[model samples]
Target: MIEAYQKLWPNRASVKNIRTQQELEQQILIELNDELTHPRVRKSKEEKLALAFSRIEQSDLTKQQKKDLVSLYKKIAAQ
Candidate 1:
């Protein structure tokens, strides 16, 4: 990776820093790509995840589904 970075940089010699402008830009692009792969977050999605247990709290036969839902909601909330 370092070798490739040096090859892409025209002023490799003067660039004493480990990460050049191009390398930094590439890193940002990689991170953006990763974030973009996830579906865009929406207000409704947040609202729904926020109310994870509200409806189910009073419902019966929700034990197993609640475990799955809480786990799923936590995962979404984290992102």
Candidate 2:
């Protein structure tokens, strides 16, 4: 669990008392939000693309949801 949290936010400080995957995930989100707010840390375009691709692949979304996601991804990629 700690390892998962560390993997999720490698550069952030180590988190303790995060036992389950869900808690680790929530802590990682908090860390990500903090990083996003900081001007010093900017996510690259490729990183954004990777995140988008992960979102498309990670969930059990419906068929139309997947199609809509792909269409949205295409629009973003076209920009």
Candidate 3:
């Protein structure tokens, strides 16, 4: 019973504390905001994506078309 409990409740040394999706997103948002505000840093990944999306939105493309274009643009930018 004690061994089973030990196995179920893993030690901190054995278990990694991974951030949840929400936590990761918040962290990324903080980093992006910092980069956006930094004068020297200029456009970060978030900024570039946002600018691209904005440009696509301004174009004459339909809603779905713009979304598809933006998705492709993000994928390429991620590379």
Candidate 4:
């Protein structure tokens, strides 16, 4: 979604300039892959958990499933 893309790349000109959903997705994927693969750009555990939670919120899973998954993630993070 446009909102997700904007949240991920708030300062990216491409996010604002995208003319199609496909283009926006492509740009987002490229940036996400770069961030993920770049060793120096490692995200902290809490940041990763937050991103995961955001994704779970956006997914098509049932509310109960999302709740369970979030609880599981929190338990894992606490360890």
Candidate 5:
């Protein structure tokens, strides 16, 4: 991967232009979609929710509080 990127950016000694923010974001979304939908990544809704909940919990929130916040955010996002 690194070699491929370096090949694509031979002139970029810093490689700063190897991936723009928009490109990186699009790639991230693509990876997230794949991870979210892949059975190997998440076998069930519970597994998906657990992965999300874990991320929320890591963000300075208690387990129950994270769940509540995630629910609230989902509601707001849906609207």
Candidate 6:
């Protein structure tokens, strides 16, 4: 998780220099709050999935195609 944060916010000094478990937890909480409250941060996986499903619903794809796509998504998620 630290590695992911480092990759996402390489400029964040706290993320780059975590030295203890407590500090890591604190940094994670701070970053998580930032992610939740900041509009410009990337959306969570569930949000992105919901957006994709919504787009699929709005698209002009055939019903069977949509069903197939959803089934494929479900299968992938199951793994």
The candidate that achieves the highest TM-score relative to the unseen native structure? 4
Worst 10 residues of 3 by lDDT: 1-10
Q: What lDDT tens digits, residue by residue, belong to model 5 across residues 1-79? A: 2333233335644444435644533333333344536567544434444554456666554556555645743443343
Off by more than 4 A, model 4: 1-38
Tens digit of lDDT per residue, candidate 2, span 1-79?
Answer: 3453344334655455667756655554543344545567767555665675676566566556656655654554455
Q: Regarding lDDT, does 1 or 5 come out ahead?
A: 5
**Residue 51 error, candidate 1, Å:** 2.2
lDDT (0 to 1) per candidate:
0.44, 0.53, 0.49, 0.63, 0.45, 0.54
Off-target runs (Cα >4 Å) in candidate 3 are 1-42
TM-score of 3: 0.40
In candidate 5, stretches whose alpha carbon ends up further than 4 angstroms from where it belongs are: 1-36, 39-42, 60-69, 72-79
Global CA lDDT computed for model 6: 0.54
- TM-score, each model? 0.33, 0.44, 0.40, 0.52, 0.30, 0.44
lDDT tens digits, residues 1-79, model 6? Answer: 3343344446766678976656655664443334546577766545544654665577666676666655544443344
Q: Spell out the clash pairs found in candidate 3.
A: none
- Tens-digit lDDT string for candidate 1 (1-79): 3333333333645333546545544442333233434456523444544443454454443466556545544544555
User: Ten residues in a row with the worst lDDT in model 4?
Assistant: 28-37
RMSD to the hidden true structure, all candidates: 17.8, 9.5, 16.2, 8.8, 11.6, 12.3
Model 4, 26-79: lDDT tens digits are 664444345545678776667777886888788766677677656755755675
How do these models rank on lDDT, best leading? 4, 6, 2, 3, 5, 1
Candidate 5 or 3, higher TM-score: 3
| Candidate 4: pairs in clash | none
User: Is candidate 1 or 3 superior in TM-score?
Assistant: 3
Please rank every candidate by TM-score, starting with the best. Answer: 4, 6, 2, 3, 1, 5
